[model samples]
Target: MTFRDVVALWLVKEKRATDVVLAACDLLVAGEGGEAVARLAALTRLEADIEVPILLPEVMRELDLPHHSRGTVEGREEGLRAMAVRVLSGELTPRELTKWTHRMFGHEDEGWRLSELDDAYDTQAVDSDEALDAEVMAEVRRITS
Candidate 1:
């Protein structure tokens, strides 16, 4: 009915989805952020090819939303490493590891992960035992001499 609505419909029909998002972003900054987001969401529902990191994120940033494409890779790896340590220490069971890995990494199956952690634990346990043996031997020699 209105000119703005007509242009928006045209942009969406033409598959210029990014332009539609830009228009939505302007509406949002004009204190209609909610309505703009709803309109943009409907238009971009099935279209994933639009990469308007600029306009869409402007609205999100203004609204204090997390707008990044992906989370930090280093942080995710560090969390997994800490979780592995807990598993090796027997503080976390295999079932718990599977559950947590599923939630965090979308990995529902963890056979290989459990095997790797078990192998690492065995290697570290052996190294610790060898160090303790050397220390006891040194103490014995010192006491005898």
Candidate 2:
């Protein structure tokens, strides 16, 4: 079944008739594009948190939800850009930036991938005990831009 079908079923199962959910599902089914998908995804995350694990992977490929090792999925660029800003502002340290970037592109809990970020994390050890703030920030800027 499609994502909208799954969402519609879930809404019925939960006995929910929220206009936002229905509207989002309708828009998504009709191929309305990113905003609708984002709205529906946010609604699902908020209203049906328990179902997200199953619902996301099984039904919502269009969402391109992030897995630990997935390369260059949606939102990663924006997130990295934001992190770069944080790094520049000193709100987050280089180490923390590395951790976040590694988490985005490397093994976190159960997933790993062959990626530039993973290679950097391995060789530079930026996520731990490495004072490579400038380097990490530059990399973040490069990728994000």
What lDDT would each prediction earn against the true structure? 0.43, 0.47
Q: On residues 26-92, what C-alpha lDDT tens digit does candidate 2 reach at each position?
A: 6566876475355454564357545343334433455553322113343354345555566666777
lDDT of 1 by residue, 14-109 (tens): 224555555665666665657436556445634524544334555455545443332444334334444544445566554454445445555323
- In terms of TM-score, which candidate is strongest? 2
> What TM-score would candidate 1 get against the native?
0.26
Task: Tell me the TM-score of model 2.
Answer: 0.36
Which one is best on lDDT?
A: 2
- What ranges in model 1 sit over 4 Å off? 1-70, 108-145
Stretches of candidate 2 exceeding 4 Å from the true structure: 1-72, 107-131
Error of 1 at 5 (Å): 54
Clashing pairs in 1: none
TM-score against native, each model: 0.26, 0.36
**103 Cα displacement, candidate 1 (Å):** 0.4
